[model samples]
Target: MIADAATRAVAADLERQSAHWVAAATTFLDAEEFASEAAWRSVETFVGLPLRRHLKVIVEELIDIGRATIALTRAARRDALALPEAMAAVQKLRRRYTQVETTLDFFGDAVSSRTSPQLRAALQALDALAGASIAPVLTRAGLAPIPVLTYVDKGMGASILRADIRLWAPGSINPVAAIKIVRHNLYRPTSLFHEAGHQVAAVTGWVPSLQESLGRSLAGDAELRAMWLPWASEIAADVFAFAHTGYASVTALFDVVGDARTLLRWPIGDPHPVGWLRTLLGCAMCRAAFGAGPWDDLEAAVVTGFPLRRADPTVRALLERSRSRMPGIAVACLTAPVPGLGGSPIGAAVDPARVSPAALAELDRTAGAALWTSPHWRRTEGIRIVALAGLREAEQPDKASAWIARAREWMTATPLAA
Candidate 1:
């Protein structure tokens, strides 16, 4: 965690940038429909820009890492260095590399500041739109509004998202939904719509914020318990948006998340489901609701923008895998956790060095087994474990070596299939 003073400085800088971003995202917040659009405008502006910036920085870090690794390899190969000199250099690089990687990959970074207009708009839009969708539902359902903070997050367009939408819940109250929106020439609108889908889950209370889940998981949420609710929540919102608004939202999401705004890069391991998959679900929803004529246009709006790998097959499959109409995010909120976690802190802490290799192996095994029951949740759990390993190493250096050894053991003992 950052020091209070450091955090405060970061917050101040974010405050400076939020204004413009809020203006750009006004439509998404739709706060004019509620409070003065500008009332929370600062934070709205603050969030999206930083989220994008953080993502940009992360992608840059990844680029740096790959470059450094190549450089290291080349340098090592160029000269016959002594063992100690080579080892010292490797260790220094490893530490520096870890800092960059940790800063980039953690879910905490996805939790953008709220004081800035960009930050504020990002939060306000997420909360406002999610609130709009959710407030009505909760009022109808007779549940009081829970105190949940919203953050417009990165990773909504990550390669790790196996589905088109997903959520993370660190607890029963706080929730976050990640949406997949690839960017393009006309991405802002499409991205707005795509995130609207994610908000549906937040409003319904399907999952917690990226920060909340990451914070709690780091704080100690059980892994299995943490993953289930969010997965259901995200999927539910995705299906709902798809079924209700159709590909307009899908296209919106794809356009922005996919587009590279100069220094800002598209995110990796984002909370949202993959854009192509999201398009598939969107098509399914539209056709199911209004018979699908414009889906290709809507879907095409996003795919046309990105340099995607499986463009043809992926696009074809979205419509191909359509199944029974998905229930809403609100419905998902009512769902409970699937069994397991053995009552351990799978969500919060995964200190590999603290546990036996057997336990580490079991952790991977259980996560794999759970995926068979619910892959949506299971994949996140696996990622969470990976993230947790990173967290432990960063915070507790004394345990890092053991954790690394156990991690290796766990990797060797557990199969990626699980």
Candidate 2:
């Protein structure tokens, strides 16, 4: 039953590493500026707060590992099986430690990259988007301080990491969704609203409900139900964005999915629908949220620009079935009363007017300079309005960053209520 000296030495080394890791993680958490400063709320609210919570979990996990290894090593002195358990525990801990390292590395990069103006503006712009568009809906639904953050990825385009396993641990702190977008994309950043919609789905269970409701609705047709099953989450997200951001969300969808190449292809097995169908579903939801005028205009523009002659036959048929059922799906998602809204639709709860495309476009003319001058546009309206306008006015990337910075400055200048 006695183990080789080399194996004993390995077990002892693991125990030491576990203790060292706990110390290092705790020290990092204590020294990290993100944990203390309220001044960093606008920017740090997105990244720093979540990182702090995650690091605490790392520290706790390492401490547990340390104790377990110590016990196992002690037991291994007499029991032969204890060596294997200790070895397994050390191996498992190594993978867990790597996860911490990767996240720490990401946090470090996120912190260091703040020197870039576009990244700063992207952070602020996302904060504004949340404060304006999502916060009210969450507040109305009885969840406050959802704490959404956006990080710039020079390598990737606009996307959301919902319930990311790396960023969240069971029984840890609150869940925060991090939106990753290309640096300085102020004009068409309404994608953040779509991303937030995914986060909302996780927190509210609205998507699951919508999926269930949609499954029941389409149950009469097995083909449609099978197709709709995977797409339920995506549709829920699109509908959520439309309901909250109204015309702005649809316009942004068009911006991203408007091209000819994207419009014609069928995205089989993808969680997202084809680009053309996504634009149309968004329009259908917009019609439900803001009325027909916005939807009609968006639909007409897409049809005129990118006709769907190139689409596959089966895909076209699936889209046709989807379109017929979209209104029912939209109603199901938008009208379901959450905790705080008193049975009103989420759109009406966030912004009563549910801004129109024409109005958003008009506001974009001023590049959101009007937001500072006019008290008429509420903070929610101002966020989408300025983002659209800034993107429209900006001819280059740096200009877009400047526009976003200006918007952030105006937003942070005063405390605007929802």
Candidate 3:
């Protein structure tokens, strides 16, 4: 009789613990958390519906687990055999609670950052640009473009969390492709397309194919082939950005990765290419697509700034061999047919010629002042305007401030298509 009384007390405690967690989990995030209506509206305009639905489903699942756990505790009080099952259920509930907490915290931080109206509008513009960058390729590859949510954060370069991946919460896939655009580069965000390229490559299976093509291209040298294969994902993303934005992508890349100190320092197992070679590879893409232009000047500056003598001898040899094959590597990235693209080269989806230096200049000449002002033009040609802005920043450094302001104006003015 005493043992029976002890068992009941334990069961009651377990039920109370589960009930407490259930109450805590019920505090779901909503627009009420924001300070102003405008803040909530801006966040709602971009990521509200999908994120809310996703969170609701997660909370419901968590609540169901908690209730089931409470039932298990009640069963434990009746039969000793039920005690172990009840304990297991409580453990499972705890695991689930932790997972749900992590998932909610991640999204809560991302959504809350958009409370500022200006930051929200800039991110919205980036969302539109990301769509413009990846839609053609994804559509051509017969894959639907996922919802893209861009947020500004501190960093020198941007990063991405793809939509197709599984999330922290069990049985949940990430609902949106979240791209982090660095704080400083909002006005000249070619890196935005690079992050979007990661999403495109993931959905289309471009990186694996490009790696194979690159391996074949460098078949003559075993060391060189091994060295380049690991960097294929980053290279494919660079190719994607270059395909959509031309020399503008190259120039923007220079600004981010052009530090002379770590230019040739290849960290063990790092996926990114050495900074010097990466800049040159971007220039190589420009040369392959547009004959010769400002990229050559930029390339000359890189070579002069980071002389081969600065690199260790083995690294220098590898760099020399890689330099010779950059043109072929660039060509392989652009022209290699992939099954995801229905056997069409990635270049076919977004022609480099469309955003070539000459093409961007022609667009500027044709559209004249109206390109920056007209809603129709802003909506239709906003991507090109982005390319042109990067081009101006690269070629005409003196006018970068004006271009930055112009970019901000259009970006805030234009909203992503519903």
Q: In lDDT terms, which candidate is top?
A: 3
lDDT of 1 by residue, 1-418 (tens): 2225444443333333232222332332232332343433333333334433433443354344444443433343433342234334444444544554343333343333333444443334333333343333445445554322343333434211211222121111112233322222111222332344344344334344422432332233343233323344445444433332233444434433443441122133344444444444454444434443555455555445543443355333322222122222112221222122222221111221222223434665666645323534333343334333433443355996775554444333322223
Candidate 2 colliding pairs: 187-391
lDDT per residue for candidate 3 within 1-418, as digits (tens), equals 1228888888888888888888877765443432244544565344567866887899889998899999988888887678878888888888898898888777666655675667877777787778778888888877775778787788789999888798898998888888888877887788888888888888888888888888888888999988998998898889888887788888888788877778887887999999888999899888888998999999999898888899988799999888988898777777766668887878888888989989999999999999887877767777888899889878888988888888888777746453
TM-score of each: 0.31, 0.73, 0.93
Instruction: Give model 1's clash tally.
Output: 59
Off by over 4 Å in 3: 1-3, 29-40, 43-47, 416-418
Q: Which one wins by TM-score: 2 or 3?
A: 3
Decreasing lDDT order of the candidates = 3, 2, 1
Candidate 2 residue runs with Cα over 4 Å from true position: 1-42, 45-54, 67-82, 110-113, 155-157, 162-174, 212-222, 259-262, 287-298, 321-343, 357-381, 387-418
Minimal lDDT window, size 10, model 3:
28-37
Candidate 1: residue 343 lDDT (0-100): 22
Off by over 4 Å in 1: 1-126, 152-233, 243-245, 256-275, 298-418
Better of 1 and 3 by TM-score: 3
- For model 3 the local lDDT of residue 307 reads 88
Q: Cα deviation of 144 in candidate 1 (Å)?
A: 1.1
TM-score ranking from best candidate downward: 3, 2, 1
